[model samples]
Structures are given as C-alpha cells and as structure tokens.
Target: MVTLLEHCRIGPPSAAAEVSLPVTFFDMIWLYFHPIQRLLFYEFSCSNSHFLETIVPNLKASLSLTLKHFTPLAGNLVHPLIGSSKPVFQYKPGDSVSLTTAEANEAFDFNYLTGNQPRDSDDFYGFVPELPPEKIELDSKIIPLLALQVTLFPNAGICIGFTNHHSIGDASSIVGFIKAWSSVTKFVGDEQFLSGNSLPFYDRSVIKDPSGLATKFWNQMSIFKIESLPLNFPTNKVRATYILLESDIKKLKDLVIFKRPTLVHASSFTVTTAYVWTCLVKATAATTGDETDGEGTEYFAFAVDARRRLNPPAPPTYFGNCLGLVYTESTHEQLKGNDGFLIAAELIGELISKKVNNKEEILKDAENWISYFGELLNERISGVAGSPKFDLYDIDYGWGNPKKFESVSIDGDGSMSLCKSREFEGGLEIGLSLSKPKMDAFAPIFFGGLHADDSMPINPKENF
Candidate 1:
C-alpha cells in the first residue's frame, strides 16, 4: 500500500541480492531472516490481576515518547521475501504460557507469572513479505518506528513487548534503552542508558595475523555436524538450550573431578550442554519401548566467542556475529556406559578446549566456517533440520546469576528460545527458546537432577 506520497520507502523484499546485507549491516538484515532476534524479553511480575492495566499503557507511552531514541540499527525490523519491509505498528497478543497459570506455577513456578494473547499488529511488529533496501527507516506507527505488543494472560501477570533490530543496538544496549524507556514511563531512573558505553570497533583485521593467539585458537577447533540421536523414541530429541547454574554445576564438576586419570572437566558451558544432553539420553531411555538398550546416539552443539581470540579480540560490545559453532557427537550406548553424564560432559569440554587452545586454526578455517554457516543457513531456509543454535543470553547486569535460563520452542521447527532463572529469590533473568516436544522432555530431566537440591525452597506452585 505504499504510495508516491509515502514519506518513507524500502525496496521490494526478497532473500535475493536486490539488497545485500553486508557484514557491516548484518544487524539490520538479520531480523529479516531471523526476526526472532529482534524480540525483547519481558517479564511481568505483578500481584494485582490488573498488571496490564498498569503496564501496557506505560509501555506504549514509553516507546512512543522514546521514538527518537530508537537507533536505525535497533529500529530495523523486516519480514523476509516481501515488498517494502515496513515495520508492523500492530501487536498480536500472544496466547498465555503453554501450561495453565496454576499448572505452570506447580511446574518451575514463576510465582504465578501469566499473560494472554498478543494484541494488534501495531503493538507487535508484523511480518514483512521480503527484504528491502538497508538504512531505510520504517514508517509504521511512529516515524522512528516503535512497536508495543501487549500479552494479557488470565493471571495478573502481563508482558509489554518491544523489538528493535540489532542494527540499532545489541542485547546490552537494548537492555539499557529498555531500562531508559521503563524509567521514563514508570517514573524510575535512567542509569541503564546513561551507563552504557559503546563496544570496541568491528574490525576483524585483528584476526589477520594467523600466528597470533586468535588464529591459533581457531586452528584447533572443529565445527562438526551436530544432531540429536533418538535416546529412546522415534520422536524424542533434545532441543538446544545454553544453561548453567551454581549448585548442579558443582555436581557436574564433582563427577568429573580426579587425577590425570581424572576427567577433562570442561567449562560450565560444555558441562551444562553435556548434562542436558545426557539427561535427554537418560530420560528418553526411561520412556523407551525397550528400556535396556541405552546405546542410542545423543548430540548437541555450542558456539565459542572468538572476539577475544583475535589479535586483540573484538571489544565485548563490538557486537554483530561474533560466534563460531563447535559440536559434540556420540552414540547413546556410549553415553549410557557407566556415567553417561560424565562421559558426555568430558567430551564436550575436551573438544571445546582443544579448539580454543589452538589459536592458529581459526585464521586458516575462518573462511571455511563462514562458508559452512552459509550452507547451514541455506539448509535452514530449505527446511532442513539440525541448524546450529547459539545462546549468549545468560548475561547478568549486576543482578544475581540465574540457576538455569532457557527458551521454549514454538512453530513446528526445532528452533528453541528461553530465559534463565536467578538462583536467589529475585536475581537477574535469562531468556531463551526451544521446540515444544523437546522442551517437554528436557524440563523433566533438568528438574529430576536440579530439583534434587532441596535447599532453594522454590514456591510449591511456581512452574519451571
């Protein structure tokens, strides 16, 4: 419906080269292919059933008033393969959490957090039909483009959603900006935005020197194909989730502790991924038709931050695509032998370490990985499964750390998302996602192991 009178215009949208999403412009164009990245993680914890009554309007006003503050990078939200990728000013109210408010409370128990269907397209950024010219500001609801999605569930809980493409800012920056908007709208402080310092430059040239530590680290790592082998059922599979915690993390360390004969205890990232994978392997076996044969293949993948490996590593805030995927592969029979948890955990840790320890490998394999990911993306677009998933969302902003944060999946695709929960009563939060069936299987295994520690006194009604 764009007209000559339109003040803003973007070219027709398509994955083709009508417009190139250069590495420099990756943040903006990513939302076109991976729009979910543009979503804001919201947690509405209110006592009164009228949470939305107090929150939604405040969120709307904050976004509207803060329009000018929305960066071109953050403001860019695109729908893939459509015309003139305009921002959808409307918000589509998301349905309530997968489980009932009560059942959910009984589960992980978020103290009865709740919300209902999403509202208008203006509130939620609508899908674009295609990619368009880069750098064009959207002309949806606001000139600067701000979207307010309201999800009012049955309970008093509500979520005020906002999405600004990464081109405008990254997770940290968005957090700062959101805090600013919340401050103004809710009558709070603006320190969030005030304290945010820009990240270092985006120069990959630092990695140019292969002999340097950065390239050495890359040389050792192998980016292998990762997939979930059915631990038990034809349908059973472990979805991706990057989570870690203090207590169980200790348990993991304890299991791998020993001498040179001692296991190669991996970092929390490696152990946790393996822990989840083993849990999946074990749980699926529990649910299998033949409980005895534990020798099925179980697998998962994780990415390492290569920024620091560069001659100088990209600054923490340098942002964009700074991750490289590393995977772990093995059979269920192998995982089930003795302590599958320990074995899987060790393998993940050793593999990641080997890759990270050798810096020279990266420079040599940089282009190879780029090409690998490119092919991977093509496969994903073609609906092929097993695309690598990344999780760097467990960041704590001075808030206490989360025990475990994960995103639940939707759509039939295996894509995952979720948030990490703070160990303390109310610490910082983490968000992530995953597909449903896999999530259902994973939740049980995690609780079976994690809930073993009864000290937390989690609310009886709160769902995981």
Candidate 2:
C-alpha cells in the first residue's frame, strides 16, 4: 500500500523496478512528425557579447536510470514508443558536460503520416533529449546534452529557442513539464522526482467512438500556408517574433463588438487570427506587382479545438487530435478594399467560437484533415511549396516570468509565426517568420501598428 508523506519524500532511490505498455502505431507516428504541430518553436543562437561565469559541477557519485527504470511505464501517453519498451538503467553516467548547443542539424521531415513502410520506421518521438547547462562567456562549453546558453542584452536584445513537440505534450503541457524538470535540478536543492507510479489516463482518444456529432464538422478543416521562395533566407536560419499587448487586445475587442453586432462575445484567438491573416494578406499584396493583386497566394490557417463541442464533450484530458483547421481566403485587393482587417478579425473570432463550440464537426475534421495532409504532401497538389503555420498565443512560464520571449525551434522552412503576450506589461508580442527578402517589406507593417503610440520607440526593428 502506498502512503502520502512516505512517498512525498523526494530524491534518487536506492533501486527501481520495471514498467511497460503497448501504444497504437497511429499515435506514435503522430507524436514524432508533428511534434510541435500546434506548438511554437524558435531558433536562436548565443550572442558574442561580454558577461562571464562558470558552472561548478558536483563531480561526485551518480546513478543513471535508463530504459529499464522506464520499462513498466509503457503502452500509454507517457511511453513515447519509438524504441523498444525494455527497461534499463546504469549505476553511473558517462561524460557529463556544461554548455550544450541546442540547434537541430536537419530540417523536419514533414511527410511521415501519409507515406508507407513499417509503422515504427518513420519514428521521431523523443525530443533532442540532451539538456545541457550553460555559463557566461568566461567559461568554456562543458555540459553534456543540456548544452544551453542564454545571456540578457539591454534593449530587447537576446535570442532564445523555444521548442514544444506535440508528442511529448501541448504548449500548455510543454511549459508545465519544463517547470517540473527545472524544480528537479541539482541547483534547486533536494530534487523532486515525479515518481514513475504516476499512471496516466490513456483512454482519451476521439477516434475510439465516432458518431454523427463527430461527422458534421468535416468541411471546416483547411490547410493554412503562405506563398514562399520569392525570397531566400540568409545563412539558412529561420527566425520569427510573436507578441500580444493588453491595449491592442482591447482595441481588437472594441472593433469586434462594433463589427459583429450579433455576437455577445468574441474569443481573443478568433480576433487575433483575423488580424494576423489580414496582415499576411496585406504583406503578400504589397510584394505583388500591383497587377497580380495577391491572388491565389493569400490564405491563413486557424485551429478549431474539439473539446467542448462534441455531443458529449471530450474529457478534460482528451489531448489527441482535438484540433482541426479553419481556412480563410482573400486577395490583397479584396482584403484591403474595406475595413477588411476589422471584418476579417470579427469573422475569425466567430469562426473559432462556432467550430470549437460544436462537436459534430471536429471528429469528421480530424479524419479528413489527416487525409488532406496526405494529398498535399503527396505532391498531388502544390500545397507544400511553402506553408506558413501560425501557432497559438503562448505566455505562461512560472518563475517571476521571463524578461523576454521568443520562438527558437521551428523547422522554419517557409514562415511560421506565434503570438505571445508581453511579460508584466500592457502591450503584445508577435513572433513572425519571413523569407530574407520579405523581412524588410514585412517589418514596417508590423511595427506600424505596435509603435503607433509615440512614447514607444519609432523603430523596434533593432530591438525586435
């Protein structure tokens, strides 16, 4: 029998046992490929400025738990079944180091699900798995896998990498888990290990029992992408900015109320997505030779979460394909003709609330969207040329809160933007991706809205 305080005591144990469970081929595949599907990823490198320090290592005794200790904990969400479910661990770990580099050497292989071959062959589950420690420039790179380096620069000058893979968890869960991991670090004192006994409720699958309610929302899903390659990136790096401020949000709220006279309330995501789409439309249009007018090239993607909408709403933890897409279409000419920004914003909000609040559509959407992804990547349609996926607004890390936020881990092929709320302030943070050529054209449009307030700097490009 397990006791409360007895189990509450934390730290490494003398010994451990084994655990394992079976996972569906489908879930495993999903976890690896679209690891950061609905999440925001950023790519940032350390600066060459001053500031130096060294990490004092506890170069003492140690015990390293490998696949064995994790043996018994398999077959569910916890066990990312990429490798065999066998459990193993060692009495000691090998070369420990400080300051690990966190950059991926390759672009993401996006065509996993639809293609063929053995189920496990397309595996991509686990994260970069190496969490290296870092110190100021004074010290040399030493840490093992956790080779991470961060330095704060004055005037919004710091690059950060934020990676949230879909398999390990969602954006919400990603931050939550990171906090948990941080608390267990040696620097934090008596480390706390979330015991392997914490069993997960693995029955949260939407496709288990599909009904008419899940069938109706099929047509609502559309793939979101932006035209690309018109410009190339310098040094092969993908970078972006995402922010959302209180004042701007209020303005958006007021605009939504004025335009959608029928709706009692408009969700923030809906309104924001509309504005983002509008910006993308305008930016693409401006790049066009007036004659083309941003035709066939302006489209945006929004998510339709399928939790509270089904006949019987999903469980509180139903975290699988609970998301589908809502696509919007317009040329720069059409979007700019009227108060398209406001109109589009209001429409986006309603589209979100309507589809998310409805269940019948989500299930059908999941099935069809997966199928559509198959067609697009299959090269049947020219869809994958360069898709710009905009992730949700993310801003919940619990320390005193971050001084700055950035998306650092995107396969950053074309352009993907993530919107973030500014820390301890009133303004917004927007993370946007652009082709090298397009960056010059896009920067002015983004700063124009945020810097509208005179007290704010005239140009944030240097800071951004």
Best by TM-score: 2
Q: What lDDT tens digits, residue by residue, belong to model 1 across residues 3-57?
A: 1111122211122122112232222222223322233233444543453355444
In order, candidate lDDTs are 0.38, 0.36
CA shift of 260, model 1, Å? 7.2
Residue 335: error of model 1 in Å?
Answer: 2.0
Q: Output the lDDT of residue 70, model 1.
A: 32
The runs of at least 3 residues in candidate 2 whose Cα sits more than 4 Å from the true structure, single-residue gaps closed, are 1-165, 186-207, 211-242, 263-265, 291-297, 304-322, 374-400, 411-416, 424-427, 449-464
Tell me the deviation in Å of residue 437 in model 2.
Answer: 3.2
Model 1 lDDT, residue 134, Cα: 41
